[model samples]
Target: MNRATVSSSLPSSPSRRSFLGLGLGAGAALALAACGSSKGASGGTGTGSSVLKWGWALPTSWDPVFSSAGWDVHTLSLVYAGLTKLDPHGAAVPALASAWKYNADGTRVTFTLRPGLKFSDGAALDATAVKKSLDRGRTDPKSLVAPQLTSVKAVSAPDPTTVVIDLTHADYQLPNLLAGKTGMVVNPAAFTTNAAGLASKPAGSGPFTLTSYTQNAKAVLRRNPTYWDAAAIKLSGVEVYPLPDASTVVAALQSGQYNVAQIPGSQVEAAKAAGLEVQVIPSMVVATLDVNSSKAPFDNPKVVEALKYAIDREALLKTQAFGHGEVSYQPFPKGYAGYDPNSANLFPYDPDKAKELLAQAGHAGGLDVTLTTAVAQGEPEQIQAQLKKVGINAKIEVIPQAQFTQIIYIQHDRQVAVDQFAGRDSAVQAFQVLFGEEGLMNPGRTTPPELTAAVDKVTRTPLDSPDYPTVLQAATATAVRSTPNVFLYTVPRILARTKSVSALPEFTVVQRFEGVSVG
Candidate 1:
C-alpha cells in the first residue's frame, strides 16, 4: 500500500452543471436543458478516452472497515481487492490469492498468494499483507465483517506465500464473505484512523486508485498500472458521481450525461427506450415484517401464527416489486444449503384462518399496530390493506434508513418494521442473523431454545457428513415454524448501463465492475 503523502488538489475536467439544476417545476420554466454531446465508444477518441464514466451513491465513511453504507461496498471493491471474488455463477474465484484448500473437518483453510502481485504503491502483496488484512477484518471493533468471523480463531502466515485462517468451529460461509466486501484488503501502511486521510488516497491493488473524492458528490480514479490481471483491465480511468435521487439518475442516463448507472426497476423500461442496456438479477436479499415478540399484542403464540397466515406473500411480490421478485417464506432462499421448500411454503394465505386464530387469541374484533418502512412507494398502503382484511388495523410510519436501527432496536419505539437483510451462501448465516442469541429481532436478544440447539447441532455436523443435511433441514424448519419474522420476498437487482458497455455480469451480492469496456 502507498503510504506516501497524498496530493491535495488536481486539475479540473469536464462538468455537467446543468444536471444539478433539476427541480419539479411542473408549472414553471425550470425544465431541464438538452444534454451535451456523447463521449464516443472508442475512448472518446483521446484524452482519457478509456475512462469509464460510472456514477452511483457515495459511501458515508471512507474507512473500508466501517464503510458498509448500503450498496457502497461495490465502490470499495474497485479500490481494494479481496482474497477471493465471486464469479457470475456465485462460485469463489481467486483474486489476490491464487489457490486455497480446506481441511477435512472444515476447521482450517490455507491460501497461496499469487506470485509477483504488488499494491498500487509497489508494496509487496505477500502472506504478511494477507494476514494483516484478515486480522483487521476479524478484530477491528468497528469492523462490520468481524461478526461474520466470530468462529475464526486466528489469521497467520507461516511462510512468504502461505496464509492460514484457523476456525474455532466449522463454517462454510466464511470463505464467501471473505470474497466480498467483508474481505476487502486495505494497505496497512496507507491506512489512517481518520476518514479523510484514507479517502484522500486509497493505496490498493485494485484496477484503479482513488485520485479525488468529495463526500456524496464525485470521485475520480486513475488506472493502476501494476494491476495483476491485465486482460481484465479495460478502462484507463473511472469517474464516479453520486446522484442520490433515482429520478435524477434516470434523467442522466436518458440524456447521455452519464454512460452507466443503476436505476430502479420501474425506470428499466425508460432506460431501455433511450438505447441503453439493462440487466435484472436476483439479489440475495430478503424482506420481512418483523414483530416485537416480547411486546403486547404479539407475545402470544397464536398472534404470531396468525400474523404469518395473514400475509399474502405472492401478492406483495407482484404489487411492490414489478413482478421481478420471488416469494421467500423462510430465512434463506431456495437452492442454498439447509433450505427446505416445505418450510418456505408452510404458511399459505387464508384470511378465514387468520381471523379464527386472532379470535382464539382473545383479539376477535381486531388489533391496531404500526408498520414502519423506509420505502414509501405504495408498499405501506398495500400492507395496510392486506392486514385490514384480517381484522387488523395497520398504520404506516415512514422512517429514514439511517434512523431505522436506532428507532427499532435501541428505542424500541417501532413495534413492527418492514425491514430487509442480505442472505448469505449458507442457510445458517441467515438463521443466525434473524434468530441467533444476538439477532436483531430475537426477543430479549436471546435465541429460542429449539433454534439454539438446532444451530449448534448443524455446526457440529461436518459438511461432508451424512448428518449435515438432516441437521440443517431441521434447523431451517424449526426457524420457519417459529415465525420470528414474516418472510415476504427478495427484491430483484436492477442495473442500467450504456449500450457501449460490451460486458456486464450479474451479481449475487454486490454489482461487479470488472471486465467492462466502453467500446
Candidate 2:
C-alpha cells in the first residue's frame, strides 16, 4: 500500500470526546440538532452540501476477514475494493478486477486488473499487489474465512495486468468465494508490514478514505479525490457515530444528527410517523435456539427434540420481533440457495408432543436448563417466557455482544444459547458456517457422522454438477432433522434514512454505506 509506518496500538474503543473532534462542522452540527424537530427537511443547496451522517452500535475494527465481524465488513465495503462484488441478489459483479475467467476444469481462475487503478495512497493496484493481499490472507491466523482457500494452491502475477490463481481442486464456487467481503483487495506494501496495521488506518482503492476513527464515539470518512470511480461519488464526507441505544439512534435520525441510523423493531413505527424514510430489508439472519449437545439434558436426542417442539416460533416472532420477522425452520434463511421449502418441519409447537418427548427421555416433569443469550437482541427474554409455558425451568443469562463469540462459539459452556448468526448467501457458505468441521454454529458440539459425510460430498463436488443439489439437500435435511438448532425466524434489518438519500441499496445487513448519497 503506502509503505507507511504501522501502528502497534490495539484499536481502542471510541470515546464521546473523540466523537466531537471528528469535525461534523457547523452545518452538520445544526442538522444534528434540528433533525428531530424538522421531520422532513429540504435537501441542502450547496454543491458539497451532501455529508451523510450515519449511526450504528459499534466502531469499525481492523479485521479484514468477513466472518470475523459484521462491522469490519461494513467498513471494508466503504474503504476497500474486493476482487468481485456481490450484487443485491448475492450474484458476483466486477469490482477492482474488471473481469475474470475460469478454466473449463474449474481448477484455475485468471483475473484482469482494471487499468490505472490505484490505492488511495497512490500505490499501484497491480497483479503483485493482488497476489500479496491474497497470500497474506491465506496465512493470517485471525482469518477464519481465508483458510477456506485450501483449494487455492497458489496465486501468481504472470503480468502486470493478468493475475492467475491456481486451485488444488476444481471448485465451481471459486467465483462466489471471491465475492465474499473478506475478499477485498489490499495494498500489499501496507498489509505485509504489521498485518493489523490497516485495522486502525485502512488504505485501499475504495470511494472513501479513513480520515479519523475514535472507538465507539465516531468515525470520519473523507472523499477520495483519487478514487477510481470518483465521478460516481456523491458525498463529500461521512460521519459515523456509534449509538448502541436504539432510542438514541432513533432520536438522532429524527433530530437530523444522523442522516441514517438503525431503527429497532419497536421504533420502526416511530420513525415512519416522524416522516423519516424507513427501509426494511429482508436479512439472511436466523434467530435460533441452540442446544449444547455436549451437555446433559440436551445430550439426549429426545430432550433436544422436546425443547424444539416446545418453542412457538410464530408466537416468538410476533412478541419479540413485533411481528416483523418470518418463521424459519432450517439453518438456511428463506431465499437462500439450497433452502428446501418442502422439507418436513421439525417442530410444530406441540406442547403435548414436547411433554411426551421429555417423559420418554426420562424427564417426565420437565428439565431445568440455563438459557444464555445476548440481551440487546430481545430473543432470549421471549424464548425464556415460551419455555416456561411448556414447564421447562429456564433461566436467562445475558452476555455482552463482545463476549458472546468467546462464551458461545468458543467456550460451549452453556447448555442452551440463542444464535443471531447471519445466514450466508451461498448454500455452501451457509453449510460451512453451521456444520463445517470447525463451524461456529455447530452447537451440537459433536459433528454427526452423517452430517460430516454429507458436507464432505457437497464440498468436494462442483456447485453446478447435478449431484451438488442432491448432496446439499441431504446435508440440509440431516442438519434440520437432527435438531442441533431450533430455527426461529428471519429478522429484517430496519433502517431510517433521510428522504434526500437515494440509491441506498438493500444489504444483508441494513447499513451499507456504498453508493449512498445525502441529497
Q: How high is the CA lDDT of each candidate model?
A: 0.67, 0.66
Candidate 1 residue lDDT tens string, 1-519: 011111112221110000001111122111212122223211322323466677665654445666544355667777778777665545455677776667766788787777888886678888888788778777877775577678889989999888888989766555456766567777777653443355445656877667666554577766665666645666767778775367677678767667777676667777778788888876666778877777768878898888888899888888777777788887655654566767867888988999999999999999998788877757778888989999989888897766666667556666677877665433455566577766545433556788888887876554444565677778888888865578888776777877777667666656666567777
Query: Distance (Å) between predicted and true CA of 449, model 2?
Result: 3.4
TM, every model: 0.83, 0.85
lDDT of 2 by residue, 327-432 (tens): 8777655554456666646578898888888889998877789988766446777777777777789888887766776777678788888766565535566666
Q: Which residue runs does candidate 1 get wrong by more than 4 Å?
A: 1-48, 192-196, 199-201, 425-427, 440-444, 457-474
Would you list the clashing residue pairs of candidate 1?
Answer: 43-49
Runs with alpha carbons beyond 4 Å of true place in candidate 2:
1-47, 376-378, 460-474, 509-515
Q: For residue 469, what is the lDDT in candidate 2?
A: 58
